[model samples]
Target: MFGRGFTLSLSVFFTLFIVFLYGPTVSILVLSFQGPNGGLTFPMRGFSTFWFESLFDGVGVIDIWGAFGRSIRLGLVVMVLTVILSLMAGLAFRKRFLISSFLFYATISSLIVPSIVISLGVALEFRIIDDAIKVFGDNMGIQWVVDDFRTTMGLFSSGLGAQLTWTLPFGLLIMFAVFNRFDPSYEEAARDLGAGPWQTFREAVLPIIAPSLIGVALFGFTLSYDELARSSQAIGGLNTLPLELRGLTTTVTDPTIYALGTLTTAVSFLAISIFLILFALLRRRTNKPSSSKRSTL
Candidate 1:
């Protein structure tokens, strides 16, 4: 339906868009293999894994491995919580009750708010909690709480909450889409087959929505792993990988930073690959012919 000129223009535009999107990542991946004596700029100074080696050997007092570990742990936790809470919320919203619309809007409002504001709010809330604890401890003569107990803005607490504010909306939205198109006859058939509520979900609803849950898990983990703004103030005393990477950009001017970037990108790709593979497998299983039907055939 289009002319040759339009087709050529569209192709050129897509090509340029792809290049613009991935050009910097490609540059970083190429430069990450810089030799031991190489600089960060152009003119590829030999090719080796020396910069990657430098990353392991300790890059100027910063805890790269520690930050990576924190990011991974937090991402896994966020993934699990997002899946559970979003699934529950999706199921709850399936039935219209009082305040359902209000709750949904409240959940989605987090997405429109600024991420740094969420970070600061979580931080301030935790500070208030700390103050409250100190007062209570002093009044109750609890020395441990007054003296030894510190802030509660660690990885699994305020950090998790802040990241959830970013991830849960996406998860809930995915679940909402998944359930919206869901066939209710499957549940009816399962009920006719004498299945209970849990069994009906397990054999009918769950299998159909398994792939979508995997997608939600992927979104959760990836978002949490790469989160910087919401995690900045909430992750007290320690840093996640993204935060460390930002700090490294200012202090470390070598290609080792590029190596770090390449490594983290590889990790993100690995997580995405794993989730996609699982999704495909679940889809195949769900679509497979039943053994009883095959035998009858």
Candidate 2:
């Protein structure tokens, strides 16, 4: 229906948009293979895996592996929590509750609020918790609490909460969209067949929503994995990969940093690939019986 000129213009626009989006990443990926003596700038000095090798050797004084582990663990925790809590919230909101509107807006308010602000708020809140613990320890004569207790901010505590503030809203919004378009007849048929609520959901509702849940999980894991601003002040005592990467930017002056960036980007792509694979599997499984039934008939 469109003219050839319009189509050509649209294709050119899309090509430029793709280049604009990924050009830096592609440059970093290419630069990461620079030789051992290579500088950060161009003029590719004899391409080699030296920088990638250097990443394993060490990147300055930073704990690269430890930070990676922390990010992975935190991302997994955030993923599980986001999926569960979002599913709960989505289900709860399916029926009108007294404070549903208020709660939803409150949950979504995190998206509108600045991430650094949330980080600072969580840090301050945890400092208050630490103070309370200290006071309690003094009053109760708990020597361990008094002498050994440090701040309450850590990966699973304040860090998890902050990342959730970012991931959960996205999860909830996804779930809301999924459930909104959901066919109720499936659940009704399950109920008619004498299935309990849990059984109904497990057999009918859950299967249909499985693909979307995989999407939510992808968002949860990736968002938490790459999270920096909200994780900055809240993740105490140790750092996640992104935080470490940010720190390395100031200290490390080589293609090793670019190698790190490439590795992390590879990790993100791997996560996305895994999630997409799972989504496809779930979709195929969900459709299998229908296809078989139609073929048999």
lDDT for each residue of candidate 2 in 49-89, tens digit (9 for 90 to 100): 99999999888788899999999999999999999999988
Give the number of the best model, judged by TM-score: 1
Residue 21 alpha-carbon offset, candidate 1, angstroms: 0.9
Pairs clashing within candidate 2: none
Q: Rate the local accuracy (lDDT) of all candidates.
A: 0.92, 0.91
Q: Where in model 1 is the C-alpha error above 4 Å? A: 292-297
- Per-candidate clash tally: 0, 0
Clashing pairs in 1: none
Ten contiguous residues minimizing lDDT sum, candidate 2: 288-297
RMSD of each: 2.0, 2.4
After TM-score superposition, the amount by which residue 260's alpha carbon in candidate 2 deviates from its true location, in angstroms, is 0.7
